[model samples]
Target: MTENWLNQIKELKQAVTHSGKFHADDVFSTALLRYINPDIHVERVNEVPEEFDGLAFDIGRGEFDHHQEEKVYRESKTPYAAFGLLWRVLGAELIGEEEAEKFDHRFVEPLDYNDNFGDDYVIARIISNFNPTWDSNENSTDAFWKAVDWAEMILRAEFEQIFSRIRAKEEVLEAAEKAEDQIMILERSMPWKKHVKDLDLLYVIFPSNRGGYCAQAVPMEDGYQELKMPFLKEWCGKSGEELQELSGIPTLNFVHSSGFLSAAGTLEDALEACKRSKELGTLNEGKQPVLLNVSHGISSEWSKEQIKAAHAYGEIIDFMLPKIEGDISQESVENFIDDTVAKILATKASVVYCDGETYLTYGIVRKLKKKRVTVLGACHNLNHEFVEFVELK
Candidate 1:
């Protein structure tokens, strides 16, 4: 029985539409038929003439219509409207059985529901709105054809997106396989969570579309609201100079207030942040308050007098500074600050005072903030810079 129906669709070269008010069912069925065979001609008519040699739908006289006494329903009990009936057979042939099933669930099912139930659904309303208004002088046939055009475009785009995601799953799985104990680094981002949700990882770092990289915490389970590991609460809802000050990583971009995700100016910085977060979680395992500290520095840009003023505040922690050369990438600067801050935190000092170039000082301050450490900048050269000992919290 199914083979006969399939053969009929395969042999079909044209679509015959019933004359009357066009619902989403017949319009979409015609659209699907047209998609299957773009060369298929569509003709509108009040009756199926004996000479007409094409599929007749929604006219109470064919296998595709539901107005007959014997109504069609799927195994799950969803009634088969004209669109659903055609899609069940043709969708598999057009795309493939797997994709056709997916399309049925994601696209066709909703449409069938709206057509069989009522016009409450958005898709049904959109198709209905394409009809000529009560006061309008437009032809219904033209409107029906226009609606078919719209439906075809929508179906094509939706199927393309679905197939793209389907193809991305393998890449996501490969990255998940390469993950370390608690963190996975994807060279490029794709839809990954669904592939990696069952993996034993807490964080995933990947290149963002906006350039640079992002570190995001994975959810604890399939639908859990909580993360396996979240960004430090203190970094939440911070950005720009303030966030830089708090994080001490100069290239640090933003941490969402909910602490689920954060952005960094470099992939290295993003990975470092994820590693530091893991370490922070380990340190916090005992429920002890982490004793965070800061260190200060003087750039060659500072004068001797300014250096002396900076030294008066506190002892400077010795750390290697990144070379400030022409056209250095922000990522390189951030990496240097990230390393410096890690070194400072190792000392267990709570605060540091330093004077340096505006950019370097801000970078150090931001990195320190990531570890919840405080900083004080002194005697900086920039106008209205950290003049006196000011705390960067």
Candidate 2:
């Protein structure tokens, strides 16, 4: 038979949980129940009575608890805490399934991981701290209630953001459909990038909450620093009449110096700016590509398969050997790092496969990032010999 109690949770009057130290899993579970039925009474006890029939979780080794010898786990292999098990059953009933799934991934899974495995999160830590200290005079029951109240605020905030994103989707999609010359215009400001990033859009124009309309470049690929097409270099950092004069857009606010974002006083001006930018073409159209290798112990550091992986990102790998014969000094290390970065900018290989001493790699990566060079890192899978190149953060 179906669980009449679970189905009739809206009418639930009394709930119970184990008495003792509390955690986010149990705290959030209580907060969620309170969110559903504000008047429901809650009890924390060491043991539940046989005749007592009420919502029970994180205790009694009942439906919600996973402390038993055999346990239930998510398909992703994350063990379900009391909170997660509750969410899995009733989350869709509260919010639609899609949004519930998102909430579970964002909030539930992390807290569940903290409860099941040793993974830590701020929510878990804060709730755990709510438990009275061994020497504290504070009441445990009061502390548990305080923690539940905080979890409710967090849960409410997450739902608000999720709902806002959902609302933005339809508006973003409509604008994308009406896009002209690779430009999308939003009627009001909302998050638009995630919805249209994969679309054939070079620029997006939206009403800025700070006033005026904003025009922005689309990234070449998500997480890539490069833009599909950046705004004109000449218009960058120009504002007021200066920007208007350069672009012939009558009402201009300011065009950022980076050429990735700009604000115009009117929607017409924003569109005009995007149109002019498309005509100007990409900046540094002929900036060379280089593949420089400046690491000590090249042959030993890299396998033949790893060397082949490096070549996939860029063509030539000029293995520039280190120049110190005896003990190396800090100055020599600095020189090697500086020379490597400079050579990379100069050759057919700013796009790189970087491997070196930890400190040297750090310096090289920092400098290359500033110059807008793509940095590559290796990822090896279960098949040890196979190596793949991926963009490094």
Best by lDDT: 2
**155-256: candidate 1 lDDT, tens digit per residue:** 778878877887778787777788886788887877777666678888889888999899998865432234677888788899878887887787888988
Give Cα distance to truth, residue 166, candidate 1, Å.
Answer: 2.4
- The global C-alpha lDDT for each of the candidates, from Candidate 1 onward, is 0.71, 0.77
lDDT of 2 by residue, 1-393 (tens): 135334577788888998888989889999988877888888999987798888788988888887987788876677889999888888887677888886886679888988987676787999999999999999999999999999998888887887788789888898899999989988888887778766988899988888889998986554344577889888887888877887777987698776878998889989988998898767444233344554554644354356555443334465655545678889878888788788777774646666554767878888887776777665542223334556666
Estimate the overall C-alpha local distance difference test score of candidate 2.
Answer: 0.77
- State how far residue 58 of model 2 sits from its true place (Å): 1.0
In model 2, where do residues sit more than 4 Å from their true spots? Answer: 1-8, 92-103, 118-122, 233-242, 279-393
For model 1, the stretches where C-alpha displacement exceeds 4 angstroms are 1-11, 49-54, 92-107, 117-119, 133-137, 232-250, 282-393
Highest TM-score model number: 2
- How close is every model to the real structure, measured as TM-score? 0.60, 0.72
